[model samples]
Target chain A: MRVSELVQRSGASLATIKYYLREGLLMPGEATSATQASYGEEHLRRLALIRALTDVVGLSVQKAAEVIQLIEGPGDDLFLTLGAAIGALPPYVESSNEQAQDYPLARTALERLGQVYDPDYPAVGQLDRALTAASAAGFPVDDDRLELYGAHVRAIAEYDIDHVPEGPAQGAIEYAVLGTALYEPVIAALRRLSHQDLAMRRFVPDSATDPAGS
Target chain B: MRVSELVQRSGASLATIKYYLREGLLMPGEATSATQASYGEEHLRRLALIRALTDVVGLSVQKAAEVIQLIEGPGDDLFLTLGAAIGALPPYVESSNEQAQDYPLARTALERLGQVYDPDYPAVGQLDRALTAASAAGFPVDDDRLELYGAHVRAIAEYDIDHVPEGPAQGAIEYAVLGTALYEPVIAALRRLSHQDLAMRRFVPDSATDPAGS
Candidate 1:
């Protein structure tokens, strides 16, 4: 297949494909002639992954490049690769002077979580950043709420892991990273759906009985 | 207090405060003089909310403005106000010509979810977008998985709504909106933390038993 077919198949624009090639986000196609190059299945897969990361996951070009490197890099360590992919996600809150005061509270919350999970894990840092953002916004999450949320998520995580097909470590790594990135919005949407349902049931009993009731 | 005091108290930059004021995301303070205006605690609170929506929830200026309108606009209806706030969140995936083929799959998935919650809700659109992205990325989520994820989130939602402070409808609306936006990252972080812990326990038995073992 040529670049044109690659573009058609991957649903990425010709310019985007070229940009990815220049950015080394996509591997160069085979040199078939002076003016023509041939893309293969690998290129198609890579292009799709790139589109998914940028278009859906909202990773920056640099972060998506890093993720591609982790996916294609010479490492069989599934856990490490998964960690890199998770790290590539945009932070919930950027570091700022305003957030400085909330770090202690964030750290304390993480310490409570540490009892169940390894506090040194990179995800712990992500958690801390989130907590700091919440506290900075004057909605400080208390220790009890954090624990309750953690326990609930642990159940979901167990189900997620259990569903991973037992196979090569590489397959597991791909599943972990892709599932984490792609299904995040799915999880969040479910949370919102649940929130809406619960809210209606508890607060708007009339509306719950007749959703059309304004 | 003046604008300077609002900035200092809210920890938002003076320029950002001015911009929000100009954008109508923040209400103008009292007209102290031709060139000076006095702000109050409400200004400070609104600034913090704007920062949290933009910085943490990642809403665009336009979306954040809509949220502010919903918050400040005349609305005694808590459910309606909360719905507007959730509706203001960035879409899980933007509509694209490339994604046209995935809509059926996304809709089917949402239909399955409708069995548990209102399928016509705005969050349902978000879930559809997410599902479309996942399917387009060649990782379509299954109905069983959606159900499993939804069950867990419903449990979490029960706790969340149960904990809502007893107060006036306006106060509950504020708590619902702010909590929804600010604590989203907290929920996501908890999910990641659980993923990391569960993965380590299931994959690296040695590390699971010996915490120091890498």
Candidate 2:
């Protein structure tokens, strides 16, 4: 298909498609004429992935490009590629968690959850940042609660990794990285919906109640 | 403090702070003289709130302003305010979920989770978007898995709202809004870390395994 059709179908403006092409995030198509080129299903998929990273996952274009490179270039160690892909995510709340500092609550939460204290992982820093922020906001997640949350999330993560298609390295890499970016809002939205249910049950007295559902 | 001090304290550029003042997102400081003014702690809090909304929540400046307005002006109904605040988050993967989406899987997931299938809530749209995207990506979240994930997230949400810092309406409003934005990264990070743990166990043969952790 032509660029115009790609833009129309993808719901992205022509300029956005052009900008992505220029940024090399979207690969160039077959040169059909002097200024015309053709795209395929792969282009559509790439566009969707790019949008998911930049718009949904909230990674900047540069970071998204790095993630794409990691996807396109899965090293000998797939585990290392996975780590790098996640590390490319936006560093939320640039605090001292980046440095090797004492985050006792984070440590407690991790130990209770049965997760190893691997300080080298970017996620440890993120966990530290989150725990610190929540604590600072007067809502310290106790060890038990943090452990419980971890169990549920670990199950979800397991389900996600289990579903990675048994195919080429590139396909699996795309699945892991894109799934990380895309499924987050799903998890978050469900969580928010759950919050709504709780609030509705507690505050909105007139609302219908379903204890069996919970 | 003065403008320079405000900039230094908040870590926002002078131009960015001035822009916020121009946009009326931040209230004007007390004018002490012709070309100078003084800010206070309230300004600092508001600045933090704005940064969370724009930087973390990925809300555009205009949308961030709207969220700020919602927080600033919580009507008599706290429930409604909560809805509006969550509604203000970025709509991930805009597809046909916005309308009365007849997503059978979504309906099943919601019903199994015992959540009310309200078409009006923005979160319903978000849930629909996430589920649909996941399914399209060939990782369909079946009803059983969705219900389990929902249960875990429900507990987290309950913990969050329970810790709403019982105080002024504005304070509570800020807590809810900021909590939504700030804590999402934390949740995502934790989930990712869990994924890392799972991947380490499954893929990396030499990696240490901790079954008791899960």
Candidate 3:
């Protein structure tokens, strides 16, 4: 397949395909001539993954490159590969240099979380960054709230892992990465829907009976 | 206080404060002269909220303005205000126009969710968009997965609404908005940490018993 065919099949612009090639996110096709290169099924697959990461998962090019590297690198250890993929995600909450004072509160929250999970896990830093940002914004999350949120999330994680298909290492790793990346928004959107449901229950419980009047 | 003092008090850059002012996100100060004006405590508060929305909640400047308008507009209807705040959030999952074919599957999942919640809710649209994007990326979420994710999220939302403080309408609305915004990343981070824990348990159960080596 040519680059144009890659574009047609992947629904990515020609320039985007070229950009991924330049950035080493997409491997170059086999050279057929000075001006032409032939792509293969592997190229199409890689391009799809790249689009999924960048477009759907919303990773930066640099972070997407890290994911690509993990996919292409040596060991087939599922644990290590999954770890690297999770680590490559850019933090959803960023800590600010000006708000160093908020770190102590965030650290306290992280310490409580560490008691239940790995203290040095990459998610710890990500959680700390989120707590720090929230605290700096004057919306500090206390220990109880953190624990409550953690408990529910742990349940979700159990379901997530329980469903991973028994298969090859690469398949498991791909499932972990793509599942985590893509399903995040699903969870978030569900949360929002739940919020509306709860809000209605709280604010307009009688409206259920009234039907048309209020 | 002057613009400089507003900057000092809000911890926002003078340029940023001015930009917010120019963009109508922040109201203009009272004019004392042709070139000079004085801001008040209201300005300071609004600036803080704007910063929290943009910096912590990651809302765009446009979305933040919608939040500001909701806060400043007439009526203390907590339900309406909270709804507006949630509605103003830009969709976390965006589907491309080219991927219209994927929407039907997403809409089907959303229809099942609608059986339990409001089908017309903005969050339904958000969830649909996310599902569509994932399906287009070849990561279609099954009905079982959607149900599993929704159940956990419903539990989280129960905790969220239960914890809303007893206060005036405006205060409760503020708490709801800020809590929802700030805790999103916390929930996401916890999910990731749980994933790591579950992965280790599933993939390396022997590591726990062996301690030293396998």
Candidate 4:
């Protein structure tokens, strides 16, 4: 398709599309002539992914590029590699039974989480970081909240894994990455919806009973 | 504190701080001299909130300014108003549901959410629009995924409401908006973590998992 058609189909303007192309965010079309180029489905999908990363989820072009590169790169273990990278961050302190001797209550709960759902170590480790960050930031997350989040994560993971069509390992990875990319917006909307749910429970007398009121 | 001090404390740079003041994202400080201005806790908090929206979440300066305006605007009912606004433009839809529905899922969720939540209509509306545009552009998403996101949102909301000292309305709004705004990084991290959890369960030998796994 022409650039104009691409713009219309993508719901992006000519200028914005040009900006993306200039930034190397959108790959160039095949140069059919001095002034003309052709695009295909790959370009469409790539552009769509770029839009989601930058425009929807609000990643910087730089950060989005890094993530996109990771997804598009030649590694079969990108998820594992990315997990390792995240786990190495200084702030990501896990609450292993051995590691959590400093915080017995937190340690006990971590063990219990292991028993309930049996998440792998990486999941637990990152949740530890998330919990730590939230707590340090003065949010009132505790063992209960962390455990709840773990359960929720497990549920979503199960659903996502179950739904994909059977395919080769690379196909599975791409399907998961590209398909799951949609969650950035989906979850953002859900967060807004949940906020609305909470606010109604708090402020509107006519709304449902407040879940947090207790 | 001087503007530089405010910048350090708020984790915003001097230039970004100036941009915020110029853009009305932050209220100006009392000018001590032509080249000097003093800031206080209010400025610190506002600057942090602005950073959360603009830098962390990647909202454009213009859009971030609008969100700041709505947040700072007068009313005991701003939370309700914000919820209403967020609901109006909701961010997700079940592809299957789009055809049968009048509004998109995000919008419908917001409207329905309004009936159950408070009435922060405008912010809710903006959030919905942003999410919808993002989803349409193909950031990974599905309805089941969004429902998990709803749970995460509620968890954060509960934590913020329960933890922040006194929990003034501005603080609540800030907590909510910043939570929503900064969600991209948070969710990205979580997505990586979740993927790691799944991969470990499937691929790793059973005796021991990587401590960095979870």
Per-candidate iRMS values, in order, are 3.1, 4.1, 4.2, 6.5
List ranges where model 4 is wrong by over 4 Å. Answer: A1-4, A13-38, A62-66, A80-144, A205-214, B1-55, B59-74, B84-102, B107-188, B207-210
Give the alpha-carbon lDDT of every model.
0.72, 0.73, 0.71, 0.55
Q: For every candidate, how close is chain A to the native chain A in TM-score? A: 0.79, 0.85, 0.74, 0.66
Cα deviation of A179, candidate 2, in Å: 2.0
DockQ of 2: 0.37
Which pairs clash (backbone N, Cα, C closer than 3 Å) in model 3? none
Error of 4 at B104 (Å): 2.6
Ranking by TM-score: 1, 2, 3, 4
lDDT of 1 by residue, B1-214 (tens): 9877777788889898888888999899999899999988778767767776776677788998987787666287666677767778856434355545344554565456553445445676677777777776667887778778877777878887887878666666766777877777777777776787677777676655654212
Residues A20-72 of candidate 3 have per-residue lDDT tens digits of: 88889888999999999999888877776776676555677888888778766
Q: DockQ, per-model, please?
A: 0.50, 0.37, 0.43, 0.19
What tens digits encode model 2's per-residue C-alpha lDDT throughout B49-106?
6775675456789888888788778887765786777777866434454354555555
Worst 10 residues of 4 chain B by lDDT: B85-94
The better-scoring model by lDDT among 1 and 3 is: 1
Q: How many angstroms is residue B50 displaced in model 2 relative to the true structure, after the best TM-score fit?
A: 2.8
| Model 2 residue A167 lDDT score | 71
- Give TM per candidate: 0.84, 0.79, 0.77, 0.63
> Residue-wise lDDT of candidate 4 within B166-205, one digit each (tens)?
5577766655654554433444445555554565576564
